[model samples]
Target: MSWTGRFLSFARDERVILVSIGLATFGLVSTMITALTMIRDDNEIPPAEPKTQYITQDTEDSLQLDTLEKLLDHPNFSIKEIAVKILCDRAANDPEVITYIWFGITRPDYEERMDSLRTLAVLTSQTGNEGLARLHDEKAYSALVRCMELCMQSTELPVVTDIHWDEYYLRDMGERFCLMFLTELINKYGATMLVKAKFVEKWLAKQAWGNTPEERRRNFKDYMDYRNNRITDIVNRIKHSRRGLRALEKAGLIDKESSRRRIRELPDLLMEVEEEIAAGEQSGEQQSRRTREHSAEEQRLRRQHREAMVLNDGTRPLGREDIIERDASPA
Candidate 1:
């Protein structure tokens, strides 16, 4: 008989068994298909995590971590934001990534540098302790300080005159990123902005451009003398310097009214900041002195008490800490 005919000719129990076998096979196949569907959905959807593992280079995924790393300054703000969020969550402690972000901020490309710094500011704000750990990194601090110097904080300093350079490069940078940096660190991170300001001042005036103390002093003096004639300097350079002042004004380091946009008015504002810093330093010194004096007095009283106790007991008196340790030891 043909196979179909044989199945029809089977006994009742055999027919039942055949039908049962067909149902079981169908169920197994359906289960496997469902499981595969779920897995594909998981891969296609956004992950619950803020940062995902970098897809391997060989993977067909277009959004590889390494690729995103290179695109931190991408013109599309969303892409850069995504890249930074991923790096901060997944690679928050990576030294290499930190250097990449910091260097990216200081890059010569004005627009790119500004974009990088904005990302970095967001990053440092979100990473908490990881950001704090980097706060003390001297190299990172110096790079940031250099970036801040690009701000024309002192109008009498110098004008950027490189023909190939963007005339307002530093000004634009200061407005968008550098000034924001100091304010962010101080307000959010509680950084000592005054110390950084002093550092930048010293580097520019003495450390950056001279040999001996006399030579350095002369260099700074000459620099001031050159910019003495503010009106003669290009308008764009002065405008850029104004942006620096605006940044300072935003930082709460300077309080200036909008009515005063004149370049000559900046010196008085800078003097206010200087006096504020000096007064803070003086106050800090006085507090430290008081603390030292109090500590010394406590030490003297303890020593005198010990001497009196020794005489009374006819034995050398031990310090309270020493006595506690002696008592705790096995006899």
Candidate 2:
């Protein structure tokens, strides 16, 4: 017989069953080999470390006092906060920590600068001789003045978002903290410090609050309030002093003519603030009236639509729940 004839005979014979079993056996062995190869490859690969473990290891192994000080300028606010807190705690025992905190005020990172200010506040708030000494530190005073000057010169507003809202809020808090700290310093050490920094007149001037009208309007009330409070504090100090203007003049703390000018102009400045506040109130009322009118108009239109729907359907008006149910029903 020919080979084709023999193959045809094989397809018709029981031996075909043996051939099928052999093919099945070959496939199973090939599959096992592939799976074993994959298993070996997986075993050779290294496992990845958890992110938290990596961070913990890095901090514990590599972070030193100087490293933490440098971390104050880190982009992450949480990192910066941690660094500042660590540095502040160290400042109590090591005065060298204060030097790092002072330099942090001059950093380009606003969060770092603000955190440094907060640390200084805590350091200065310590009771007894230590606190007194920190408050009197000329270097601390100079750093504080430099921080205020830098803040005043910074006209750019950071973009506000949910992620950045804390930074924005801290910036405002920092400004207020700076002012309050300055007030405390003046009260304790006198205005000579400000005079020496040549910031006395700048503080007296109307500060640039914002770049736009909307921003200015938003900040107007708070800025004016704080400014008024600061000026009032200074005026009160000058007035309550034992020898008054003459004593201030003799001590060369503040210019004699300048003090007289500020006193004379105080009433006019206060009257201007009151008038502006009244105008803002009136504007707000107008806006509220417009909003109420708009709401009423929307309610009226909704009622008309409901009435039309009832007339067209020849039935009771469809309520919100009824409409929702009708729409949700399977077609």
Candidate 3:
């Protein structure tokens, strides 16, 4: 009676265990199958439609200049960029295109303004079509000045926490593009265009360095270096131009008196720029030395405070006054 009862009880327990294992296995397989099905469905789903329809080069080329100009004001950034590219190509031949593109600087959209600045820069660049003299006309120069003024007005740097960071970033990009355009113009025509030099000097003077004193010092040094390099480039260009003027004078194509006057002016400009460069280098070195001194002082204070903390045996942190007193009283 005891053997039969034990056997039957063991058999019943084995069946319960087997059924529980089967149920658990079935639940696991069900979950795995559900997940696999979800992944397969996701893979089968189509991608989202693009914001703007893709235009082939042929299609873009077929678009009228007027149509492209109108697209400059489109809300879609890509559309504006395409318009600017087309306009840049057209502006190489058509002076009227400059008129259309220059007005883009006044556009409320930062993207449009940036694209316009870029296009204008390309048009007036040294590598650009030299035959398009209108690219450096008073109207174009005025547009550049207007763009620079806008940039200077919005020169306040944006932070990550700022809600207008995107706008600020775009504006900053536009400013850089405008500055490039102005630099190209200055290099190519500065020998004759006194206003360009004066305007650039004014713009450079108005530039904001940075938010913090340390940042200001570092950025100012970099700014001085940039200015020094720019002036050096101008001086070199003047020297090259004077050589060309001398050649022309020898060839009797240019009046000797006029060429001599021009040559004399170039040397004066070169001397002025050299003096400015010398001054900038001296100022930059002083600033850098002061910054280094400041950083060293901060490091010394930090190291002394750390030593004071260790000297306290981790029992209590020393206050600034205690650290100063400890340093002052002891060797």
lDDT per residue as tens, model 1, 145-231: 666554434333334332233323334444435544544344332233434444324333322334455554444344434543221
Q: Give the alpha carbon lDDT tens digit for every residue of 145-215 in model 3.
A: 67766766666643322222223234466666655565565454543232432343444334454455455
Minimal lDDT window, size 10, model 2: 317-326
| Deviation of model 1 at 303, angstroms | 20
How close is each model in CA RMSD to the real structure? Answer: 21.0, 20.9, 20.7
Clashes of each: 0, 0, 0
Task: List the candidates' TM-scores in order.
Answer: 0.32, 0.36, 0.35
From the highest TM-score down, the ranking of the candidates is: 2, 3, 1
Cα error of candidate 1 at position 54, Å: 18
Q: What TM-score does model 2 achieve against the real structure?
A: 0.36
Tens-digit lDDT track of model 2 for 67-146 = 88678779999878767655554466676776888898867678899888877777766433355456555576677667
User: What is the TM-score (0 to 1) of candidate 3?
Assistant: 0.35
Off by over 4 Å in 1: 1-84, 107-112, 125-133, 151-171, 188-331
In candidate 2, the residue pairs with backbone N, CA or C atoms under 3 Å apart (3 or more residues apart, or in different chains) clash, namely none
